[model samples]
Every structure is written in structure tokens, then in C-alpha cells.
Target: MPPIVLTIPEAVTASKMSRTAIYNALKDGTLCARKSGRRTLIPTGELQRYIDALPPYTGKV
Candidate 1:
């Protein structure tokens, strides 16, 4: 089974987003994260929700 939580780097890889983008999202409340000790973890479902909430592609650009 896939992991339920992903670290910052793992989230970047799985979402194909830059580390800065992920951090920005977290900072801006666009994405949610959890704390495990000193590590920040993103839930797979939360990431999926964030992606789903994005506007659909219109193929205009």
C-alpha cells in the first residue's frame, strides 16, 4: 500500500511540485500538513484534495 503520509521531499516528488511551491502552499493555507517530531508530513488524501481543487486545464496555454 502507498504511504498515508509524505514528507516534504516526498510530497514534492509525488505532486511534481517544487519544494518552494509546497512550502508556499503550506504557508498560504492552500495545503495542510502534520507534525511528527520535527518532520512535516502531508497526507496523501490532502494532497489529492489540493490537486482536485485546482482549476481544470482548458488547453488554452
Candidate 2:
């Protein structure tokens, strides 16, 4: 089973997004995360939910 949460760097890799983009999403309330001491973790389920909520994509041009 996948871990319940992912570190920022791990989330970036898993989401295929830049660190800035992740931070922007977090700041804008588009994504959710939890602070564990000094580390911020994004829940795997939240990540999946975010992806699931995105509009359907067309094929690459």
C-alpha cells in the first residue's frame, strides 16, 4: 500500500509538478497538506482527489 502522506519533494515527484506549483496550489487552497513539526506532508488520498477533480484532458496536440 502507498504511504498515507508524502513529503514536499516526494509530492512533487509523484504529482509531476514543480515545487513552486505545489506551493502555489497549497497556498491557493487547491491542495491540502499537514504540518508535522518542521515537515509538511501531503496526503496521498488528497493528491488522488486533486487529480480526480481535474477536468478530463484531450490528447496531446
Candidate 3:
């Protein structure tokens, strides 16, 4: 199967998080992305793992 990779915009949308947030996550070791020429791509598998590791959502007042 083709490796599932997402561009910055696509990843931002997928994660519902800002590009800066994504970059910060990468810098802090919470996220990992690959740099190809002028583009940064995030592997879908890694993205999924990150999501799965997130704390559960809690509705709050």
C-alpha cells in the first residue's frame, strides 16, 4: 500500500489543531513528521497513534 502521508494543511485539518501546534508537538517529541524538499508530511499511522494516545474528551461546564 502507498504510504499514507499528510501535508501540513491536511494534517492540521485532520488533527483539528493549528500548524504551529503541530510543529510544537514535533519539536517537543509528541509528534513526528518528515521533511521532503519544501514540504512536511506526517505519516497517517503515526497520526493515528497520536490520536489514540490522546486523553479522552471530557465535556465540561
Candidate 4:
């Protein structure tokens, strides 16, 4: 089966970011998205790439 594109709410849930943060990232070119008519969509692969590109987290000692 084919993967599904995510809507803003879906992306928020998947990325665990606030709506404002997602919009900011989109505005800053950190996250990629495409418009289909009036709906904004993020490809599953693109979201995965963004997550994969993030640096690893290290907790404070």
C-alpha cells in the first residue's frame, strides 16, 4: 500500500510540535510542504527526512 500525505493536524501529531511551531518551520524553510488547492500537505517521506536530519538529543548530566 502507498503512504499517505499528512495534513497540518496530522503533522502536528506526528512531529509532536505546536501549530505555531509547524507554521514557523514552514515559513523558515525548515520544513517542506505543498499546496493542493486550499489544503497544505506534507509528504510522509519529507516529514521523515526532516526528522532524520535533526541532531541527536543529549540530556543534561
Candidate 5:
């Protein structure tokens, strides 16, 4: 079974995004994160939703 939540590094891998991007999203409020003591977790569903909501590729250079 897949994980219910992912660490920041896992989120970066799953989303194929840079760690900075993920942090930026969290800082900018585009992405939501949960606190587990000193750890930060992102729900898999939320990550998928964020990916799905991204603008479709137009093949522009």
C-alpha cells in the first residue's frame, strides 16, 4: 500500500519537483502541510490534487 503522508524529501521525489519549490509552495500557501512535532508531512492526496490542478502542458519552448 502507498503511504498516507510523505516527508518533504518524499514529496519532492513524488512530485518530481525541487525541494526549494516544495518549500516555496508551503511558504506561499499554494500547498498545505501538516506538523508532526518537528516533522512536516504532506498528504498524498493533496500532492496529487496539486499536480492535477497544474496547468496542462502546451508544449511551448
Candidate 6:
């Protein structure tokens, strides 16, 4: 079958998050993910949603 999902690495690249950051986001419930067997798969739609909804980043508070 064709590829219908984006993997963790792809999601990280798209999300511009590091591995630890992604895991942290997942833990914090800010980012969403799924497990397929032994691999983590992130839905492109949801990734986009998160990206679009992310708050603007500044140098500091």
C-alpha cells in the first residue's frame, strides 16, 4: 500500500522539534502521536493542526 502516514522523524522535521522535544511535547499533550507495531506514526493532518495552532516563539518572556 501507499504511504498514508508521517513517521516521527518526518513529523519532527516538519514540526521543527528535536527528538527529546517531540517526546516532551507528546508527554505534555501539546503534540499527538500514535504507535504502529514498533514504530511511531504521526498523522499529517494533526501535525499541520499543531503547527498552525502553535503560539509564536520569541527570544524570551
TM-score of each: 0.91, 0.84, 0.78, 0.82, 0.92, 0.71
**How high a TM-score does candidate 4 get?**
0.82
Q: Is candidate 2 or candidate 6 better by lDDT?
A: 2
Q: What is the C-alpha lDDT profile of model 2 across 1-61, one tens digit per residue? A: 7799999999999989899988998999989999999999999999889878877888877
Cα lDDT tens digits for candidate 1, 1-61? 9899999999999999999999999999999999999999999999999989989999997
Q: What is the per-residue lDDT of model 4 for residues 1-61, given as tens digits with 9 covering 90 to 100?
A: 7557999999999889799988988898988999999999999888888888887888855
List the candidates ranked by lDDT, beginning with the highest. 1, 5, 2, 4, 3, 6
How many residue-pair clashes does candidate 5 contain?
A: 0
Model 6 gets an lDDT of 0.78
Query: In model 6, which residue pairs have backbone atoms overlapping below 3 Å?
Result: none
Alpha-carbon local distance difference test for all models: 0.95, 0.91, 0.87, 0.88, 0.93, 0.78
Runs in model 3 deviating more than 4 A are 1-3
Clashing pairs in 4: none
> Which numbered prediction scores highest in lDDT against the true structure?
1
lDDT of 3 by residue, 1-61 (tens): 7559999899888889888988888898888889999998999998888878888879875
Show the lowest summed lDDT stretch of 10 residues, model 2. 51-60
Q: Looking at model 3, report the run of 10 residues with the lowest lDDT sum.
A: 52-61
- Which segments of candidate 5 are over 4 A away from where they belong? none
**RMSD (Å) per prediction:** 1.0, 1.9, 2.1, 1.8, 0.9, 2.8
| Per-prediction backbone clash count | 0, 0, 0, 0, 0, 0
Ranking by TM-score: 5, 1, 2, 4, 3, 6
Superposed by TM-score, candidate 5 places the C-alpha of residue 58 at a distance from the truth, in angstroms, of 0.4
For lDDT, candidate 2 versus 5, the one ahead is 5
Estimate the TM-score for candidate 5: 0.92
Q: Kindly list the per-residue Cα lDDT of model 5 for residues 1-61, writing each as its tens digit.
A: 9999999999999999999999998898888999999999999998888888888999998
Error of 5 at 5 (Å): 0.2
